[model samples]
Target: MTSGMAEDHRKPPMRDLLADAAFELFEEKGFEQTTVDDIVARAGVGRRSFFRYFPSKEDVVFPDHERCLDDMVAFLKTAADGTDLVEHACEATLLVARMYAERPERSLMRYRHIRDVPALRDHEHIVIRRYEHALAAFLREGFAFRPDGPLHAEIIAAAASAAHNHAVRTWLRNGATTDAVAAARTALASVRAAWGAPPTPAEPDDYVVVITRSRAPLQDVLHHVEHALARIAPADDAE
Candidate 1:
């Protein structure tokens, strides 16, 4: 048992080994040029261990989102009822940004690689959608009584993800500095403010019916509706 304990400490965890190997290979051979076999060969791990940690090559480019998302879900579940859901969602989504901001070089590398590669970009979107879906699901439970609750939840979830992504992209494109994280926080805060506001009334449908006097003629009703619309609609400035 003592020898086994020593052996366990002797080797780096397979997950870390695979990640390090993957990034090193990505940097050396370019993301497109690297293969799973190449990464495993560099890390001295088997193919089985590689799959256990990451589902695809692109997964290696990003942090362990599986765990991060689980953490976010847990964080949300424990949130107090008094906390504004929108603000809490924004803060939770920032965790994703912080995961990247903590490792600037790796984050920048992954960001660039994803931008250059369409497949990786698609994969990244799928991961982001997972976060949005999870957030929406949590919010739906919180707002189950309302008719438009699900839609509102989805809107907030999408907004949260968009804000985080925008900040991370801005940071990567400009320069990966400490200022980047601050930029990310500011951007996330903006989303919380903009989307967190009271939702605007939905646009009217075509051919709306306006109730008036029972004896009112069709022409009078039409005029009433038109006048009401004109009052609400923006004035056209065109000459």
Candidate 2:
């Protein structure tokens, strides 16, 4: 017999089967009353098989989330040089939004179930934190920010993730017909505006040397000129 067959021929990949079965049972009898054994029986699998794939019945509802997070991290890591970090982060966030949006019905069902359950809501928060941590790591590495660098990058990551989460939750609440991708883009725009634009290149010095008056203090005049230049110069020019 083939290794795959020898290892476990009781059913197909137990995770997927259990997930489908769990969703069906949840839909039929509601999430609160469903049990792990019930899901395994519906999937034609054993209790051991179900436990091997998922720790609890609640987990069957969130299939492939770890894979999705891994994919997002991989996508961000492979971003080309010269791509804006914020833009790259936004794209990564969009990738996640698309993953959920791709299976709108399943996503919506999971969202609804999670909102009504305290344990699921807490688990979802943990997942959200993982994504935020991954994005913040990317930002810190990509920008070469100091360990204690300005909280700007971390703040941006939090805002971006929160925005994406809000968009997805709102879409689910609206029956999942709304364009979540567009809503995500709108949310990311708010994050971008919060972060503002990238740094501009320094301009070449072009100030003319002016001779000073004999009666005026040179220090005072120089200070006044410096302040004026600061106010009048473009950020790039000042840089």
Q: RMSD in angstroms, all models?
A: 10.4, 7.1
RMSD (CA, angstroms), candidate 1 = 10.4
Position 217, candidate 2: lDDT: 94
Provide the TM-score for each candidate, comma-separated: 0.75, 0.75
What C-alpha lDDT values do all the predictions have? Answer: 0.78, 0.80
Clashing pairs in 1: none
lDDT of 1 by residue, 139-194 (tens): 88877877999998888788778877888888788777766656767887767777
lDDT accuracy of residue 45 in candidate 2: 65
Native RMSD of candidate 2 (Å): 7.1
Candidate 2, position 206, lDDT: 42
Could you give candidate 2's per-residue lDDT for residues 99-164 as a string of tens digits?
Answer: 888889889878878878888888888878988998988887776755654376788789899989
Ten contiguous residues minimizing lDDT sum, candidate 2: 1-10
